[model samples]
Target: MAYKSLLTLASSAEGVAAAVDAAARVALASDAHLDALALGVDRSQIGYSYVGSGAVILQIAMERAEEEARLNGKALKDALAAQGPDLRFSLDSAVAQLGALTDLVSSRARYADLVVLPKPYGKGSGPEAEAVIEAAMFEGQAPVLVVPERGFAAGAAPRRVVLAWNQSREALVAARRALPFLKAAEQVVITIVDPPAHGPERSDPGGMLCQLLVRHGVKAEVAVLARTLPRISDVLARQCQDLDADLLVMGAYGHSRFREAILGGATRNMLESAQVPLFLAH
Candidate 1:
């Protein structure tokens, strides 16, 4: 299956360019329609008690934020127009109520084939961005394409890709959802790190997953590495670099979110450490 419809959310002017570039690239690659929603914070939903003069300042700040959001939306439209001459794309703005931003984004993403989002930057690592990611991966029930904060290319989809396989339900789902990308990629390496000794479905390491992908017209090779590092994410990152992979496809949040939050897991570590594009699903 191919990605026919894609969705993305832009939260700030600073990240609008990158977000549009990444989204447009994917849309162009898949010959899909892109729908980008620019986000603005609604001050009325804020819980701060406004004092006499403080209320005026807060109102002004919120107005500025709203205006910035509008400008960012326009920039997105212009960028999409320029980058996607043969691609279908649209841009609009959405005011995110304080507590309902995640819900709004999640509900909107449910209608999309894939969701593209910008990775967190220095000061951009706020609740809003985190919520958008959480909403897309868990609540949206769609594959999430995360672009890095810096140096995002708007021209082409990744040619070389690495698939981190673990024989888990989430990993299988992620691989299947990423079939389009895998089939299009020039090279696909199914990297399995420290596979379990035995699982319910027993077979040669990575062979079963590889055969499933082959049936989909994706020719992939399996690379099994012994678990020698402290964090599997680090190994995956190194493998991506060694293979010169432009994209990494893997499962997200295989374990409970709360558990990953407290103890850390491959999904969390990769989300934070990966510099290349990531195609992730729950």
Candidate 2:
């Protein structure tokens, strides 16, 4: 399905430009309505985390944080204007406690066809960024697209795309969610990292998936790679560059909520180091 409504989460002040750029890029490509959300923490409610117990210190910190949030909102509007002219877009802001940002983003994302988030930075990233990522993936019940720190100017639309295919429920879900992009892409490579040892072996690893997409007017070719590298994610990342792929679509893997909040070997690795934009769903 095509993304008729796109929502982008700007977790921090520094991420506004990247978020706007990504949202606008997709909206322009698919003629979708774009909604950019800038999340702000109520400094008074969250001051204790930054400042000690003193009331006066907390008040000062809260004031500074609030002011910064205001400036961030203004900057986001300016960026949107500069980048998304002639595109249908809206700017919104939300203020909540640091602990509740995830729920807010997830709830808002429910009405959206796709949720775009800035990639988590190495440092200086608040909990809101991480929470938004987790909520969008697990709670939004929608496709989550993570734009790298470099920003999403990959192409007009994801012309060269790679779908990481495995015979798992998660993979199927991811593929279905990314159908619009696959159908629109000039080239689609269904890359299967490694085949399973057991189960009835199919003549082609990614053949069934290719056929499925072909039924929907997507011409996808299969590419199989042996698990010779130390990390499958690393190999996948390299393959993206090798193929000059602009987007990488894959399923997110996480176990039970009690065991691990977000735990997936390849998912984690790609989340941390993927240079290309990623379209993921759980």
Candidate 3:
């Protein structure tokens, strides 16, 4: 189905423009309604219990929270006015305290067709971005598009899309969630790395997926690449660069989150290396 509703989160200076641009680009391409949420972190919520704090301190804490929200809201609005003036959109702000941010973003994301996250997930990202991404992917059950933190390529569009294939449940879910994009894209390639020679995928790793997508008019081609690099994410990123892909569609956290985190899994690796807009589902 075509994406009719989209949500985006922006909080910091580095991520605000990129997040908004990604959302706006998709909304324009799909003629969708866009909702931009400007997020401001309220550190007091996570820092102090307030059991020993005086009334004056509590008041100051609340005031600080409100001020952060207000500032982020204004920044989001300015970006929207400057970039998305002709698009159908609404701007809102949230005072995101640590513990409560998950519930807030999840609830908002529940109604969106796709949620646009600002930065690529990995090291050096803020806690607020991580929380919002978890809420959207796990709790909200929505496909998320993580855009570049700086901006998109000058003339690139999502028309050239690549889907990483592994025949896992997570892969299937990600592909299903990204169907709308595949159907609309001018070119779609299903890239598969080394395959098991003894399994059902012995002869063709991504052929079955291509067959299914063909029925849906996706018209995807299969690209089976040998893993020359130690990291699969490196291979995928190199493939995208080779193909000049505008978007990379792949599954997130195929294994347990803890295992992935500890082992430096594909999801984590890709999050750190993706050069294009990355679309994922858990």
Q: Candidate 2: RMSD over Cα atoms?
A: 3.1
lDDT of 2 by residue, 159-258 (tens): 8888998888888999999998888889899998878866444566888889999999887999988887888898799889999888999988744433
The deviation in Å at residue 152 for candidate 3 is: 3.7
lDDT of 1 at 83: 76
Off by over 4 Å in 2: 42-65, 200-202, 254-264
How far in Å is the alpha carbon of 25 misplaced in model 3? 1.9
**lDDT digits (tens) for residues 164-259 of candidate 3:** 998898889999999988887788999988877787888878888999998999969999899999988998999899998888999988887678
Q: TM-score: which is higher, 2 or 3?
A: 3
TM-score per model over all chains: 0.88, 0.87, 0.90
Best-performing candidate as measured by lDDT:
3
- Predicted structure 1, TM vs. truth: 0.88
For model 1, the stretches where C-alpha displacement exceeds 4 angstroms are: 42-65, 150-155, 200-203
Candidate 1 residue-wise lDDT at 92: 79
Q: What lDDT tens digits, residue by residue, belong to model 1 across residues 1-282?
A: 788899988776555566678777777777789998888865453346555666776677678668857876876777677774687877778776557777888888998998888775445555577678878778888898888766343346677889999878889889988988899878789999887778643467889888888888886899988778899999999999999888899988988989987999888888777788888998
Extract clashing residue pairs from model 2. none
Q: What is the descending lDDT order?
A: 3, 1, 2
